[model samples]
Structures are given as C-alpha cells and as structure tokens.
Target: MKVDSVTEKAVKAVLDKFAESYARRDLKSAMSLIAPDDDVVIYGTGADEKRVGQEAIKTQFERDWAQIEDPGLEYNWISISAAGNVAWVAIDAVLKAKVDGQNLKFQSRITMVLEKRGDRWLIVQGHFSFPDQSQFFD
Candidate 1:
C-alpha cells in the first residue's frame, strides 16, 4: 500500500522518538509518546511476553531498568507504513546491556505497531526477532 508523504513523515517522527528514548533510557519520555491504553506484544525465542496497557509497561520497565547499567538501544528504521489510525515500524538494531558483572549484546529485528488515539500516537504492539548470533545489520 502506498502512503501519502504526510502519513509517512508522521510515522517516521514517532519512530525516531521511540529509538531516541531507548538510547537515553528515558522511560518517562518514551511513555509520553505512547497511548494510554497501549498494548505491546513481543515475540522472541527466550522472551515471549505480551505487555498490555501503558502503565503495565511503565511499571515493568521501570523495575527492569533499575537492575541494569548503561542500557542503550540503537535502531535502524527500515520501513514504516500507515493506514488510517494504525502504523507499523520495521527496525533492526543492537541492544547493549550490562547486568552486574556480565556484559551482553544482541542483534534484533522488530516490528512495532502504533495507533493514533486522539491527538497522539501510541505503541499498541511489537513483534521482535533475533536472527542468528552473527551480526545481521552490519
């Protein structure tokens, strides 16, 4: 489906904010971008969990981030399409994290869905995959 330039730009702006938020570990800023009743669905080999509502996500991440150090995300926005009120962002990125003495890195490809609720866009769903241990994006 072809989207007008305006719709495409709008989607891009939201996606940019999403990436920057994770990079900064600014959960408050990220949560502000999401809709109040947003739902997030994540699909991966080790972590398969569906997070519903913005508050649930906020609570979970607040706790999760508290346990980590220098948690940063780098996302390459591959594609974003919008039809009416719903939009999807396809991304490939690397997540670098540290848990106490252990350091970890993972390559991730994810699709995030956002919905326009009133005057703002909210992240409603996300499906993520890790394609092999080798770096796929670089």
Candidate 2:
C-alpha cells in the first residue's frame, strides 16, 4: 500500500527517536519503543546474531553500547511503507565511534518490520547489515 505523507512522518519519528537513543545510549528509552516480542536480527560478514524478547534485546544493546565510545549515527535515508498491520522501514546509516581507542566506522543498512498492536507500533523483525558506501546513500 502507498504510504501517505502523514504516515511517513510518523514512521520517521520512530526512526529518529531510535537514532537519538543510540546516540545517547539510553537503553531503557530505546527499548521502550520496541515491541515486547521483537525479533532483532543483526547480520554482517560474520555470523548472524539474533535476539528475542525485549529484555534480551536491551541487555545485548547495553553490552554493545558499553564497548563503544562517542556513539553517533548518520541516517542517510529512510523510507516507510505500510502493508496491513505491518510497517516496513528501510534505513541506511553510518554508525561512528571509537572502539578500544581505534576509530571505527561502518555504514549499515537496516530494515525493520513493525506490527501495529492496538494504538502502538511494535517491531516484529529487524535486519541489520554492514554495506559498502556506494550501496548506502544511493
């Protein structure tokens, strides 16, 4: 289904808030936006990491956040589309930080499917992967 401008804006709010939470490392606030039964998946060149449930997701994020210093994200682009009870959000962002005193940066493209539960939208599935710069912005 074609997503209206207002719906797009609302979805963008969620994405922006998520990015803000990452930049601030506010684990509690960040997880609050996610669905309770969210299935978070992270895939790159290495083994795929999958976490279920909000508690586990929060723990994983907190651990990961602890390892990085000066976390910031540059959201290159994001598109939100709706289909039935689910909202598909595609995002490209650069996660920048210093890991173990070494400058670390990577461009990641993330796709999240959020299912609407009553009046709130909760994430059902998440896919995150590191991609090349050329594959990012364009």
Candidate 3:
C-alpha cells in the first residue's frame, strides 16, 4: 500500500527534528527522537561501534559532542517510506566540525527506522557510515 500523506509528514517531522537537534547539540532533544526501549540499536561509523538501548546511545552521543566543536549536519533525503506503524528513511549527509583542534568533514549515508507509538514516531534503529570509496571503482 502507498504511504499516506499524514504518515509521511509525521515521519519527516521526526527526522527533521532529529537533525535540527543534533546540529544544535541539544542532547536531550536528540535523545527524545529515539525510542526508550532497550531493543533500540544504533550502528555508528567507527568499526565495531554499536550502541544498544537508550543509555548506551546517550553515552555515545555525549562522547561525540565532547569531541567536536561547531558541528553541523546537512541531510538530503534519498527516500522515505512508511507501512502502518513502521517507517524507514535513507539520507546522504555531510557532517562538518572541529575535532581535536582540526577541521573534520565526513560525507555519510544514514538509514533510520522508526516506529509509531500512538501519535509519536521514535527511531528504533539507526545506521551511519561513510560511503566506501572502493565501491565506486567496482
């Protein structure tokens, strides 16, 4: 079935808020977008970096914030689709910041899965990674 307009809007709003919160370094608002359940998972860019549950995710975010200064994120949605209570979003984003007294820029691809609980949608899973340059030549 095609995704209804309302569901699409709700999902987009959640994603937008998440991006905005992250760019602003508002840890609380960023955490609010994620589900509180212990099953929620986040796979980050670093090797072997996987965070399970809210507390783990929060700690990871705190570490990230501590390492960067003036962080900014620009997201371009590749696609968003919803079926009933579940939705997934794919996006390409550029993250800019200062890390360890040096400028850092990462072009990343991100995928997020969200589930609707009542009227609110919360991220249940998120994966973030830089595109592998090897794939371009294959």
Clashes of each: 1, 0, 0
Tell me the deviation in Å of residue 91 in model 3.
0.8
Q: For candidate 1, lDDT tens digit of each residue in 1-138? A: 566688777777777787678667888888877666544543433463446677777765676577677777677656777789888878887877798868887788888888888767777776666787665575
Q: Residues 21-92, candidate 3, lDDT per residue (tens digit)?
A: 887889999999999999999998888679999999999888878878988778865578888899988899
Per-residue error at 22 for model 3, in Å?
Answer: 0.9
Best by lDDT: 3
Q: Candidate 2: misplaced stretches above 4 Å?
A: 38-48, 132-138
Model 1's C-alpha root-mean-square deviation from the true structure amounts to 3.4
**TM-score winner:** 3
Deviation (Å) of 30 in candidate 2: 0.6
Q: What is the C-alpha lDDT of each candidate?
A: 0.72, 0.75, 0.88
Answer with 1 or 3, whichever has the higher lDDT: 3
Q: Which is the winner by TM-score between candidate 1 and candidate 3?
A: 3
RMSD in angstroms between candidate 3 and the native structure over all alpha carbons? 1.7
